[model samples]
Target: MSFTGTLDKCKACDKTVYFVDLLSVDGITYHKACFRCSHCKGTLAMSSYSSMDGVLYCKPHFEQLFKESGNFSKNFQTSKIFN
Candidate 1:
């Protein structure tokens, strides 16, 4: 099959995304407007963000969630002391 098109579906909205309006992260493509922090619903167009299990989050929210889940360790200070 020969395919020659520059269209992809936005991972968030499942809508068509043209090449010019596409934003890619971690090999997933989203419409520029659809790329947002899943927690706060904030736009992530020009800021640092993280993705977990296919969901996007801003740095602050990412850290907050991890901290709340007890997955974020503050033991770095203790490790430093031991070293």
Candidate 2:
């Protein structure tokens, strides 16, 4: 019998992250399909995304949640936005 040693899991789904469909961001790995907006459950692209406190959000949701009246959040959470 053959064994595939230790598997890497997707943080969102808690499922195995196969090498072929891996999408890693900010040191975290996910399945290409698992890379989605946390708030709206919408699909996201590697080219554009917003990450806050390790959670991912689509552009609109991120703006709605973090942006307020032309003002930004008070550094409550470190964000890494790729757009």
lDDT, each prediction: 0.76, 0.78
> Per-residue lDDT tens digits of candidate 1, residues 1-83?
86455668899998888877888887898988899997788989546887777878888888887766667432212222343
The ten-residue window of minimal lDDT in model 1 covers 74-83
Per-residue accuracy of model 2 over 1-83 as CA lDDT, tens digit each: 97573388889888888788888899898999989997678999976688877878888877876654344442334466689
> In model 2, which range of ten residues has the least summed lDDT?
69-78
Q: What is the lDDT of residue 24 in candidate 2?
A: 86
**What would the TM-score be for candidate 1 when compared with the true structure?**
0.73
> Residue 41 in candidate 2 has what lDDT?
84
Task: Please name the candidate that would achieve the greatest lDDT relative to the true structure.
Answer: 2
TM-scores for every candidate against the unseen true structure: 0.73, 0.71
lDDT of 1 at 41: 88
RMSD of 2: 8.2
